[model samples]
Target: MGILEKIGDIEREIARTQKNKATEHHLGLLKAKLAKFRAELLEPKSAGGAKGEGFDVMKSGDARVVMIGFPSVGKSTLLNKVTKTQSEAGAYEFTTLTCIPGKIDYNGAEIQLLDLPGIIEGAAQGKGRGRQVIAVARTADLILMMLDATKSRKQRTLLEAELEAVGLRINTRKPNIYFKIKKGGGISYNKTCNLTHLNERLVAQILQSYKIFNAEILIREDCTVDQFIDVVLGNRKYVKCLYCYNKVDEISLEEVDRLAHEPNTVVVSCEQNLNLDYLIEQIWYHLNLLRVYTKKRGEFPDFSDGLIMRNGATVEHVCHSIHRSLVENFKYALVWGTSTKHDPQRVGLAHTVDTEDVVQIVSK
Candidate 1:
């Protein structure tokens, strides 16, 4: 049978198989096999494996945020409202046939917003050029999953399922599992905590299914078989996803309130221009970006221009952001911000910087 057919068969087998101690190893092995087939299915059709045209937009700005949802979900409307770039907006399906990029300046930082074509059901299965859409989504620092407030709840569910099927774990972290292959020694399995879902024998079975005869496995926490499969495949992306429910004006206040209360969710009406400012705020918040200002030895710091950096950025990062060769002659940095114990404190390259901090590089 073909790869898709094999995947379907394994999925069916896994679904029918009962979950219990008796069939745990079997289930784990089946999951590993399923993961392998899916990985192979995603392999490039050509040998070179280059990206197709129209999806090759250069990444710009301090951070990137991509909008993904069903057709006519107001992605284009939202993009046009926030940024000067005018994406084609319509009330019909598949209005956007390609990825359109726009830049929005917020808090003195330029953020790149992408309006991707609306994806359909079975997107992950290569339907409606979804592989291209998902390919672009993987490059995003954040995912803006737009949903129609008037549509059924399944819209969000289906969109999430497509993203998940392509190995995008939204609002989650990678599993803490250490695995290494060895040449001579046998399997060395160890764990710090009690694993309820996985045991030594099950791990061995799963490894053997992948032809991993001799390897070292360390389980840091109790994780599922699918998580283990993710570790083995090692191509999964863990990104922050904000669920944006648009067309809130078409829904009741109670329904809108319900969606607003959900974790990492925002309610907005693009047509009514409601809650767009708050949406931008949440975008910056989720990005966790910091702005650092630079000062000269005898001059005032330029308040209008600031260097954008991620949270936990060190003085060394600041130096690199200034220039590639700046670090060579770097003596030290005088930091004036909350990250330092005292204002204008002398710090080494290892010192971390806070938002809106004034940094002066003292060179030799």
Candidate 2:
């Protein structure tokens, strides 16, 4: 159960309470907030393995990849192409009624991926269930604006415009800029590249880098959402991934090349199984995450059951994320990672860790 489930429970309770005409502060606020909460809850959850892109157990940079595009544009097909997911794919629109998650192995690191419901025009007006998916885009590390290359240029523009309305900018330009630079070469005959999303803070004076503007999740470390979004999307040093182009089975190699010229864009065919491996490789490198293994007595530990924390996430937060009492009783955490040479089972809370470290928290 997520925040929505809990909000739903409260709304249902308030509705039941209101049936008898008990309109108090709690009930009144519930009434006012019910609609918003419902919208947030219905935002197509990507509850999948390792973790869903842009979704972590907490409100942090745990997972980082989300796919948003028009319906039937092969978003779910790409979801199945990479990551640990078994989502449904079809020839018709809106086949994926929910957001699905998948896990992909990137150079020994675990990268989370999300496949969301399709977006249609006027989604902000709740047109064709677009509003729901727009909400989910708030919780992503990166957004993949999947487009139909086979569609006419007018149709593609229409899709891009719809995304723009939702505060997400898709990279669809040809004249090269600083989004993704060519590996080798200077000013003379510099190969043009197509970037997947609008990654740069500003593409030029007229263009803002295209991306989903989910204002809620972009909170500063102190809880200021606006500042947080600025840092995540605007920070050039942050590890950003690629924009995935799917459904290439019906398109031409030349078209794919044209798209690849955009910054961080990859061409793939989920239907015909083309270039999927290369796409994964690019995504892994862009994410910049690494995995280290931990074993005791030559046995693997359960990551799900195991409390996984980021390198800087406080021990208190981990305790709370696992169970509140640990944080309430709040002793220290006994970490078991590369820092400890003793038996893996015999480490203490003060031990710092390297990546893929296994830890055990000791509390009263």
Candidate 3:
């Protein structure tokens, strides 16, 4: 059978199989197999892989965010509203045939926003440029999953499944597991905390399925079999996602209130311009960016624009961000902010920086 047929068969078997101690191992293996087949399908044949064509757009700004939804679901409208760019919105399906790019400047950070073509059922199966669209999303720092307020909530589930099938884990953190493969040593399993979901033997079996014979596995947290498999696969993308329900003007206040209460969800009406600023604020917060101002030895700090860094960034990270050569030449950084114990404290490269911190690099 073909790859899709094989995947379908495995999926059917997984669905038919009951969930219990007796079936857990079987289900795990089947899920692994299914994931393998899906990967194979998404993998490009040539070394260069599939070209972006119309789907590929150059990434700009401090971070990239993509708008994903079914066609005519107001994704284009929302993009135009937020970024002040024209992205061809209509009342028909597939109004956007390619990726449309825009920018949202908030809090001194320029965020790139992309409006992509509608995703359909079987998108992960390469239906209607879905692979290309998802490829764009893989490069994104954040994914805005736009949904129609009038449509069934199941659409969100379907979109999520499509993204997951292609190795994108939304709003999920990476499993705290360390796995290393050695040539000679046999399987060594170490657990720092009590594992309620997985045991050593089952982990060994899963590792064996991947042809990992001599490896060391460290489990720092209580994770599931699927999470373990993800570590073994080692190519999954852990990204943050915001569920945006558009056309809220068409819905009732009760419905809007209900969706607002959902975690990581925003209710907005692009036509009515409802809650767009709040949405932008949430995006800024979730991006978790830090603005670090650089100062010279004998002059004042540059306050017009600050260097944007990700949260938990260190002084060394700032150095590297400025130039790769600066890391090697770096001596220490003087900081004046909440991250330092005292004002104008001299810190080393390992010192973590906080937002609005003033940094002055002292080179050797």
Q: Candidate 3 residues 146-168, lDDT tens each? A: 99998899999999999999999
- What's the CA RMSD for each of the models? 1.7, 18.2, 2.1
TM-score of every candidate relative to the true structure = 0.95, 0.47, 0.93
Q: Residues 1-364, candidate 1: write the lDDT tens digits.
A: 9988998999899999999988888888888898788777777465775556648789999999999998999999999999999999987889899899999899899999999999999888888879889989999999999999999999989999889888999999999999888996989999999998898888888888888889888999989999988887789999999999999999899999999999999999999999999999999999889899999999999999999999999999999999978789999989898998888799999998999999999998
| Best-fitting candidate, scored by TM-score | 1
For 20-55, candidate 2 gives per-residue lDDT tens digits of: 333443443443344344434444366665733332
Predictions ranked by lDDT, top down?
1, 3, 2
Residue 219 of model 3 has an lDDT of 95
Considering TM-score, where higher is better, how would the candidates rank from best to worst?
1, 3, 2
lDDT of 3: 0.90
Off by over 4 Å in 2: 1-62, 153-160, 168-241, 291-364
* Model 1 ranges off by over 4 Å: 45-54
> How good is model 1 by TM-score?
0.95
Give the CA lDDT, 0 to 100, for residue 16 in model 1.
Answer: 98
